[model samples]
Target: MMELAHGNEVYTWPGEAFPLGASVKQNGVNFSLYSKDATRVTLHLFASADAASPQHSFELNPSIHKRGHYWFIFVGNIGHGQVYGFQVDGPWLPEKGLRFDKDKVLIDPYSQAICFGRNYSRERAIGPGRNMDASMKSIVVDQSDFDWQDVMAPRHSLNDTVIYEMHVGGFTKHPSSGVDKGKRGTFAGIIDKIPYLKEMGVTAVELMPVQQFDVNDAPQGRQNYWGYSPINFFAVHAGYSVENDPLAAINEFKTLVRELHRADIEVILDVVFNHTAEGDENGPTFCFKGLQNGAYYITDKETGNYANYSGCGNTCNANHSVLRRMIIDALHFWVTEMHVDGFRFDLASVLARDSNGHPMKEPPLLWTIDTDPILCSTKIIAEAWDAAGLYQVGSFIGDRWNEWNGKYRDDIRAFWRGDSGTVSRFASRVLGSPDI
Candidate 1:
């Protein structure tokens, strides 16, 4: 049993493993995580976001709390705004591709919200001891709390779409953007610019990685402003929210989508499922590396080193059964809960690779995304290449998937630059590039 801030005692129950991540129930919140090789798992509950240590910790017994590869527990009396994380103990054999650090307080892979405390440091998560004081924690969120106000997606067709690829912060961060000082460079700032987007005839706005990412993933003094270095797939980037609260990112992003939908414009996210912020082996153990490294990433069989298919230090094992499910689930959540109109996959060719980083004839993850019932109406665009030279531009898998035309872009640029013998190619590009 546990005591709450309200002075009520609540008991712990053996939670179900079907629905993953933290789920808020009527009685309490149920937490579930997948760690196939973990020998021991402990749940740490924080009193607040910046709490140096856990107010309470429960070591999950494999006999009762574990089902298959999932470990779950339900703590009554605790509901929304509960800050928590996991510490999984297993074999730490990096040569064989198991990098488990029980000392590190790992965030949930399916976290709906992440709370980066005042003491949170990315450096502390590397080559670590106990990083509870410097770690980012996950929050138990009640996803149903928000009122979307019956806003429906515009669902614009590709033929009629004029996409404006934009960075959320850069869109309104400038002093002359006219957005309020407090709301600048945030989801609220985007909401304030709906009129301008409508005036420009932009049918869809492809937002560049709004998913929660590590700002400290960049070099010594520089921060990662592009947001391609994702930390959590399900959570919206809290840094994009005007409010400091973790849940504010979720609701504020929803409000941005709702308001954009009202203005007859669609919201498309530039999703990076190819790689994560937890870079190569020497990088930080944020979430995936701490949970089950081999399962989440594509590692070299002989050396046990990370495979850099995405040229971003590591490549996600997208075709792995566990990761395949996660990618689909994230897409479903965005479509159903967040009301997103589409996804523009970054370095999408990486998703077409097999376990050993070989391009598959038919990758399961791409097929799953192509046929996902919830995403049947959602627009799906692929960059059609990886940084490691795996190009699938003209032959990208799946019937519904759209590929970004690099040939057309280059040809058009050459023609306008007065390059000789570029007329035929330019004419072909004008007629939708049939030659490609």
Candidate 2:
């Protein structure tokens, strides 16, 4: 804390921009957040995950810490496990498409791990007043501390892969799962059942979204159990973690990957980059919606409402420069840091849409992922369609990408039911369907 003339103490230093997230350095933690229209940004530090209010809050000095659209700050003496969040002040003009509320404590867009208390509520973040107690806090993590023991992605080719798609939660969620009580429905549960997966002779496990998603994203009483409603792209789901600590999820997820690789089993995540848990303009002010709604989501130019291409209410502005870079960076982290083999993009065709929600002939983001040096060897698989009827099974942009083959599924189903004229299509599907 720097002592001011008035005897108030403020802990802060000018931070850099290259590393976007909360980077744990030798001296302290460096936090950098991107906010193009925000007039003011404050860094709030808390003592614990359930801290009702921040112990210390320091406003970023624009002249010193602001670099273009980024508001960054380096705080001394704070290391890993430090709970933090951001508060941005700007115009609340919905018509012009800028929604910033200083009252809402937002999780960092680049947060590797997120922590929420019992009082966390999506309703509290919707309208007015400060939701500090109800807000999700971002934790500072030192990713370099994990010991993989020379473990790496199995790198199983798409041609030789027999993918077994499974849900992480349901894999062990049942009472008859035979997994230990505490370990049930968790990453450790998957580790326990490695023998079974090995016996099945599957090369790759296409995991349904393990990314930190909103469990409360379902209907009035139901819960989002599939993990499709993602809140943080980089974070491992806290519900899957055995421990309450925010860092435990990351470490446990790594342990799952390491153990899977030991058995020569490749891990492929069914990533949901198409839409966030934040539903629409009426949804809660989460990370992306509150940070830069216009930059992150594909908004209707006239209504300023979100374009629902993914049928998830808000379609991500995937082709935009900011989001495109973020998608690549997130993938690189999962590959280089998390040691994941590949990705199966949910609603992969959404990535093909332009800002106006129209399909592009050559989507830059798709081609960029195909040619990216970091992602070149990484298996790129696509669901090959969106909820908006943008199918790209045969016409998907990149040559490296393997499609889900929706036509193959239909044809195979038809043949099983002895449908007429299905023989030719079924044969084509068996031979990799050149006409699909």
Candidate 3:
């Protein structure tokens, strides 16, 4: 984005929509996206909601822009399903990685349809003093279009993947999952547990945090039973919606990711950008600390404050720069707006630290998400290590990240909890994670 943040304050009227989205131009709707590691960009217009909150807000740094790699702007008339997001700037200096932060309002990680939460509720996108959360705020959705009928996307392959990690409301919501009533744990209750995850063969379904998060976060004193606290990484979790609608929770989670990618199967999510649900500074003012608390976290450059590094207190100054375009617009909206295939990241060596946290063997945000060509083939996976101890584990330079080999989840939970050398370390982690 910027060396410190300012792509005309993020699209008051962005352009270059040959084939992108949100395009109703008689008055307004040109918005386009692609950061190429931002240095400047801006567009955080809001003015829709009322009884629930979210009215006439402002921000626009477009001066007829369009810098390389992608950062266009064109705020002429402004029309059609309006609600906006963008706030880029440059360099906050975490070593030399560049984090930018023109006062926080980011979220277009290639947004497919957002316009979501917290108006009548009081959290109002937090950050002023910690409201519940929706990470700086970025709604504007009116493009759900829904038509997936034939569906698609199981496309499995990290060695024919198997992943399972539950909790879309506790995978079916206990009570023997009789379902019915409240569609027990939604997305059509995982589309009725997708034939029980295709009869347990698994294939792939990772989801620990369907983006638009922030449930019960009181410093994890114990809320979000296990969502890993993320927020609007390009929307999705309107309380896991079975049908409460958020465009039916983005068309039943894109028809449950097009019926598990049309039987090929592959969803991996778990994100968390190492701290959000805005928990720090006494925890809760939301929206990256009131639109720019020292530019999205990791303080103490000398006591400016916050830098817990995933202790869950603060730590997401993700090298800052409009919080790294809100972490590359929430990973390009989970791979072009929730088509998803991979991303685990959680602490990921506190995303390669440096916001004064330290360790950075060369982490320019994990090497710009490992030579990102729109995240190469996606799948980065990390949870590498953080409660601040900094453990890369089996190494982590990243060119396309991978590492939940975490000593193979502690030797298969210590060999199915029995522990003793455990059947040759669980057959060397199923022949070393090819997941044999």
Candidate 4:
């Protein structure tokens, strides 16, 4: 507990802070961020979508910060989609492994829509709290909604499955795609073109990543390119939604699934739980790290620096219960609620790492997923290796999971390139599982 020399209410709080995001049980929203050496942190609230011009921003009284380094203040007056940024002030000592730049406006780790650019330089603010409603925090947008239609899980058997992996954008971005000019490359666009997908003989459509992420990271067209970096696991990409109403887009996605079910098609999500969009100390703070730094990441216990296991920079200590739950709930929501077929885990081996960065012989996370009753029928495909050089293709085959068979990618590339002996290796991959 940090005991101030003097008991003084540093700043007047408008309301209480809620956990994660605005919640029904929440009387206020909790504002949190990670900075091991940060001296001060302020929550800036904008009246409009303009961050350069905050309507009113204030620093929380130091007395309110919890042991977990969280600042809880009741912020009842603010509605959802309220553009916010964090200004953290601390030592800029990099050699000591700390990069605290108060000048750089940090994003809320839990932000649903990550606005582009550094600091106030833009007019449009993007982050999901709930700009669509002025309802009480109790009126929080249910990322998970109730549907009585049916609990139709896409049990796509192995031999029958023809997985068509494609980007939600690329498929429609091509002018020749013949998609509706308005609905091009959107969730609705995909739904609109589901018939074409059926016609192509694809039983399962494995999406790159529909999870909300920072497309703006590639705003200049440089590209975070592949949607490998995930921003919010729970929220679908706002840009991909057919309409501005994200909830409606979700319902429409569900409807698309229902329709596809009638036609016997499945939706597989390419999920990146190995790491997040938050690159490193250099990248912006979007979620888990901001919620709980040391807890959510595998920090160098000695130096308190983040470990980079997923190649994305900050390796999520996926073994952590809270973060692990976030990953699990996201998948469960996709499968049980949205009726998704399965998940292809990018960098599956990282999930096998313990919080301390050691590879566990039997990682609890992998085991639980393999045996989850709700996910028993779910098809699990692993990228099988990670950027950290943990290769487990045929090495780490678990029950009920399929490794991506990277060897297939290598051999197939060789064959298409007209390399010799490719035919024999291709036969083995086609005939059997990479399991052995």
Q: Which number leads on TM-score?
A: 1
Tens digits of lDDT, candidate 4, 237-340? 65666674445556666766677776778888999887776666555544444435655667676666678988667887888776776677677777766778
| lDDT digits (tens) for residues 354-423 of candidate 1 | 8899999989999988988899999999999999998888899999999999988999999999999999
Global Cα lDDT for candidate 1:
0.90
Model 2 — TM-score against the truth?
A: 0.95
Model 2, position 122, has a per-residue lDDT of 80
Task: Sort by lDDT, best first.
Answer: 1, 2, 4, 3
Candidate 3 lDDT over residue span 220-249, tens digit each: 355666767765356677678865544457
In candidate 1, the residue pairs with backbone N, CA or C atoms under 3 Å apart (3 or more residues apart, or in different chains) clash, namely none
Q: lDDT scores for all predictions? A: 0.90, 0.87, 0.63, 0.64
User: Candidate 2's error at 397, in angstroms?
Assistant: 0.1
lDDT per residue (tens digit) for residues 112-167 in model 2: 88988888888898888889998888988888888899866677766688889989
lDDT head-to-head 1 vs 3, winner = 1
User: Candidate 4 at 62: error in angstroms?
Assistant: 7.5
Give the clash count for each candidate.
0, 0, 67, 18
Order the numbered candidates by TM-score, best leading: 1, 2, 4, 3
